[model samples]
Target chain A: MTPSHTAESARRSAGDPPPAELRSRLLGALEGLLAHRAFDAVSVIDIIRAAGVSKASFYFYFASKQAVLAELVRQAVRRGHEAADPWVSPDAAGPSDPVEGLRQGVTDGARLWRENAGVLKAIVESWGSDDGLRALWLDQMNSFTDAAVTRIEADPEALRHLGGVDVQATAAGLTWLGERLYYLAAAGVPPFDDQTVLIDTLTNAWTATLYGRRAADGRPAGGAIVDGHEGR
Target chain B: MTPSHTAESARRSAGDPPPAELRSRLLGALEGLLAHRAFDAVSVIDIIRAAGVSKASFYFYFASKQAVLAELVRQAVRRGHEAADPWVSPDAAGPSDPVEGLRQGVTDGARLWRENAGVLKAIVESWGSDDGLRALWLDQMNSFTDAAVTRIEADPEALRHLGGVDVQATAAGLTWLGERLYYLAAAGVPPFDDQTVLIDTLTNAWTATLYGRRAADGRPAGGAIVDGHEGR
Candidate 1:
């Protein structure tokens, strides 16, 4: 089967909106190109050629190459939110232990980043240079931070020891930390690319910030999870 | 006085090499432009016009706009290393408390990024897209990681609790985490710009990963610093 077959399968499985066939095709082409080349170096001609679409068609769906990138970033954000559901959803029966739930979230988030390294790398690298992309990324970060705040607010006991910490700002900082660390790791930046180290380091950070220690044994008094035995 | 006159003053005070006047002019121009616009958006004509130099002269000291960025990144790295001197210098009498030394390093590093936000933002945003910039950043990261490794190696007790963690990978991960977090903060990315939250969250992460807890109060029993009183 051809490459469009994969896109078609993904589209069908995800139940994309009607009339999005061409848009998905263009996105697929951009993804294919970005897989092997830096986003800045990939031009409109390259994207159209890779997508097997005409210039006019590309414009019909995207204002410019950056628009396409913004769209890709939007999709990445959606996937990221979905991946974070296991941990962020307040009602979800997440891992019995809060720390385990956070670790699971970190693992899933890292996997999502590894899978979409190309688009994520482009989005991260374009953070400051492209306002549209930056805004899109910032929007996602805000959503993640909000979810983190909710998580922390819902479980005051889990974070009671972090008495003076500004939960909102703390959530925001940790979310950005995760975003940057994962971007660096996914982009194959040295030292960050090692999956085990990257994920564990991130989990450790998240746990320490939210749970107040690296492990249950290391936790401070009154900072223990409700069901610490479930973590293992 | 002309802009170059100011640059000349900065050069002399900073002890820049002699006969590098024009080069400094172009760099100053680039810095001025970057402060107002993104690096990729700034053009060669813009640099020359801002510097009051001609095209040929622009090419005299730098091969391209990216070359100017590389120089700025190089200088930023040097400044970073200098800022990190208190923490990374092998022979220096660093903070008597390991956590205190780490906190001092994080604070100084954050200050350096805040001071050089414009150029550092460009370098970080250009990371992956430009080989030269990426190499420069990667080199700085590697050096930071090496220094971190050395510190950890030197402090067997402070980090003994982290027995299972890969110290090298851990160091690399933390270094990148700092880089990305600082970039976002300096670039004024939402939720990460709060100095107090960002630094404390980062310090918490670093401390947790290295010493296994959020603070001296929570530090693993056997992982106490040689002189905890000095930290206060």
Candidate 2:
């Protein structure tokens, strides 16, 4: 078969043709570039070249390079939310344990980041003092954490087992920690990617802060899903 | 007095003005434009105009706009380290308690961030992946903590008052918590800037996590300084 024929067959087998949306393609390109380059080093020309789209197409979708980055950030946050979707609201009910939900959030966060190391790393590590970017990132983060807060709020009784924890602060802290953790992994830092250490460190740190004296041994046992559990 | 005369007088009174450093002057100009404009929106022209330097001069000092930013980040990190210097190696052989030393570290960290918000925000919020920047930031943080850790190690007995807390992990957590706290403040989110709240939340939060309970019910209880005493 010709190369075109082989390409068509590969695409056909995949169920759907590749994304035609300029936005998706651009985001993909941006994500790909970020894996190896910091935000400051990459130029608009680089992004357009990597996207394999003309400058006109890129401008049609985004006003500037920064705009593409903003969208990239939004996409990463969205994926992070999707990661946590499985554990609490969808999987269990009635005083559902947040422990599993949290673990899934961390795991999914790690997975999405591993997949899109380029984009997430660039955005998280390259904060600027400009008010616009600051407002945009904070709003995006607030929205992501708000969804998590709403889920927990939906079943107030679900968190009742959490006792006297500052639910709002706890949720916020966990979300930030998850983001920072992913950033660390994307930066090629090991030990953080040590699934066992990650889960253990995160679980112990957060649970102890939330439950207090309950996780002192650095391990929460009994329905624990503790450190020894497979990270996958 | 002529405008030049006043400027000269101001310089003279400020101390024999040192000869202007070329790179620093360019970096300052770059930062001024950046502080007012989004990172992507600011261009070589704006930077040169703001600095009153030719494009050639700008290029001579820095390779790219991003390099200007990287330099600014280094400067900010340096300042942050200076802000925390007072507590890094305190005169006290060690605190009467280990928690106090951690407390000093966090408090010093908050002050440093507050003192240097602009560049700190830039370094912390990059949209592109920057291993170099992350490594720079991590190095600055580790330097500060390593100083504190040395002090703590000097008196293991003082650190031991915690009932066997993991000294190294505890130190890392303290540094991380401080960085995270200041990040919220630097975000320019209102209510989060309340200096008292910043100090109180970080100090109490660090105290609780390390010692199993916040020093004063999450409220500052007459810290040594009058202003940083309570976050409420």
Candidate 3:
């Protein structure tokens, strides 16, 4: 098994899995509620009511509303990391075109963000004020950066050109950039229009930074290059 | 005068300037207060008390506590725009080395953000929840982006290579990226350490994006290229 898979298995083994059905219901309820309102405005009672779970059951697995949101963020971060498989997975064969591989990774990452935009938005917006959320979000960012550093270290050619760049810091800065940009887009901020613009513009920045060039070829670098199904 | 200057002058003309002494007192009070606490946690009463001004006097010049914060944001934005003179001012003459010019701009911008880090942080963290603050912040970002776009458009060589890049969108994205990065740095978030790392990493990204290359020369890009005294 790959190191990443083993790591995942080890993580899973370390913790008692939440009663899957109740946890799923709570998460789904939070997601549904977040789709319409800001997270700060949502209350624990609201989550319990939406989940159709008793208060006692709500406390059975989680400690607070923040804990539930933290769990949701943890899931989103895992999904986001997994979606970045095109670039981060060491065992996965490198794309025939390196730049295109970077673009595909960015595109997939954007798609995942868009899909979970609500929960992701909550995490981004609330983290500044909520210590628990902030720690979870920071952990996620570091994990993504760690994955990026690993990918860069594994690829000799990419590593050569990144001589002066601080690999860890660059990865961290870029990761935060993607998060903030996608958050702004999801929150309906200006200049961050539809998904296509968000995806393309971000892919441009990522490709430029990592590959040292623009995605000039008009080829659609979204789906064809990366095996989108592997992570699932 | 340019359109932006005309707009600024017009804005100045629209309102009777606040009594210099009272305004200074209030601003100083707010700055002192913000140094210790989050903007949201601070109240209007706190400002008036700190300023040693009557409630009526506070209302005479400012509409709310938010108005005070908005004014601070406006001043910070104007200072930041001025600090970007090295890169954005068209008739100011481009630097001898283009990449160095870009680096200097990034460095100046970072310094301004660092100087007013507290107010800037308050604006960033609080704006997400407040519509008025959000609009003010968005206006600041767009103005910065407009300046960047203008700079890029004025330079024929940079413009040419930016063919695939939607110049305005690219500028806007980079501008937001800079804002978020600086915000993270100013907020003391992890991986964004001392001023050197912040300035260097950001300079690298800005130089790469605008020039389509890194700042390869080892020359000091901070003070020599641009008249640091121009904006002050």
lDDT of 3 by residue, A176-201 (tens): 78887888788887667556657667
lDDT of 1 by residue, B167-192 (tens): 77668777877887787787766446
**Residue clash pairs of candidate 1:** none
- Candidate 3's residue-wise lDDT over B1-232, tens digit each? 3455431342235457554567777887888898888887788889877876768888887888778889898888788776676677665776766666777787787789878877888888877777798899888888888888878888777776666566766787888888888888888876675565566667767666666665552323333333232211
Residue A59 in candidate 3, Cα distance off native in Å? 6.5
Per-residue CA lDDT of candidate 2, range A1-232, in tens?
Answer: 3455332242234546555565776887877777677776788889876766678888888887878888787777677666655543645552244554455555666677777777766666554534455567667666666666666556544355334334455455556666665665566554354444455455445544543432333232224433343321
Ranking by TM-score: 1, 3, 2
Off by over 4 Å in 2: A1-52, A61-76, A86-104, A126-136, A147-167, A190-193, A214-232, B1-83, B90-104, B126-135, B151-170, B217-232
Listed per model in order, the count of residue pairs whose N, CA or C atoms clash below 3 Å is 0, 19, 0
Global lDDT of model 1:
0.74
Alpha-carbon RMSD, each predicted model: 8.3, 7.2, 10.8
TM-score of chain B of 2: 0.70
Q: Which candidate is the best by DockQ?
A: 1
Error of 1 at B215 (Å): 5.0
lDDT of 1 by residue, A1-232 (tens): 4576533343345555567577898999999898888888999999987876779889998999999998888888788887787677755887776777777788788888878888988887776777787788788888888888778888866456555545676677678778878887877775567665666677767776666556433222223223343233
lDDT of model 1, residue B12: 48
Q: Would you give me the overall lDDT of model 3? A: 0.73
lDDT of 2 by residue, B1-232 (tens): 1233322232234443344444665687766665555565778888777655677877777787777788787777777667656555656464655566666666677666765566666666642335565577777667755765665566544354434344554455456656666878766553346555566556555555554454443344554433211111
Candidate 3: regions farther than 4 A off:
A1-26, A48-64, A217-232, B1-26, B52-64, B91-94, B217-232
